[model samples]
Target: MPRPGSHKYDIKRSRLRNELDDAGIPDKRADELANEILRNPRGLRARLTHVARRFVPRPGRRGT
Candidate 1:
């Protein structure tokens, strides 16, 4: 049997993939992107910012 949080993680990952699909993203690509975001230290926030950046431009200058 999986650990306590493992099931929750699976549910969350599945939900993320489903949301991506609902947004019209291809299944394979969505899965890949979801996995990438989940691999990040701040997975949920990283996923949000990744999607948000497509519609919202950064406020700061382009280059430092």
Candidate 2:
């Protein structure tokens, strides 16, 4: 059994590193970012920016 929070991937780590390197990122940077991606504690949900939402009009409102 895999440990808690383990990432499941078909590709080996060396292959991933090579692919990242092939993608034009520096080897060290790619490896660091890849490790961070797999081991991130906060999970992979996209974080929203702090921008205010647009004013959406409510449907079915009575006409004044």
Candidate 3:
């Protein structure tokens, strides 16, 4: 039997896979990447920083 949060972990994994797919990553590669990220201690923070950088503009001159 799975532990109490096993189902939740599965759900989070599935969501990560879907997000990767939506970003144009192939299914197999997405699964691999998702698993790698989830297995890392700092994965969540790293992933969040990566995603946040996409939306948040960098402070710099108009054209450099």
Off by over 4 Å in 1: 1-5, 41-64
Model 1 whole-model lDDT (C-alpha atoms): 0.69
Candidate 3 Cα outliers beyond 4 Å, as residue runs:
1-5, 43-64
| lDDT per residue as tens, model 3, 25-57 | 679977876776676747768875775465445
What is candidate 1's TM-score against the reference? 0.55
Point out the worst 10-residue segment of candidate 3 by lDDT. 55-64
Per-residue alpha-carbon lDDT of model 2 for 1-64, expressed as tens digits?
2233445432444565676677566789767645544455354233111111112224775423
Q: What is the lDDT of residue 55 in candidate 2?
A: 23
Better of 2 and 3 by lDDT: 3
Estimate the TM-score of every prediction. Answer: 0.55, 0.42, 0.57
Error of 1 at 55 (Å): 9.0
Q: Which 10-residue window of candidate 1 scores lowest in summed lDDT?
A: 1-10
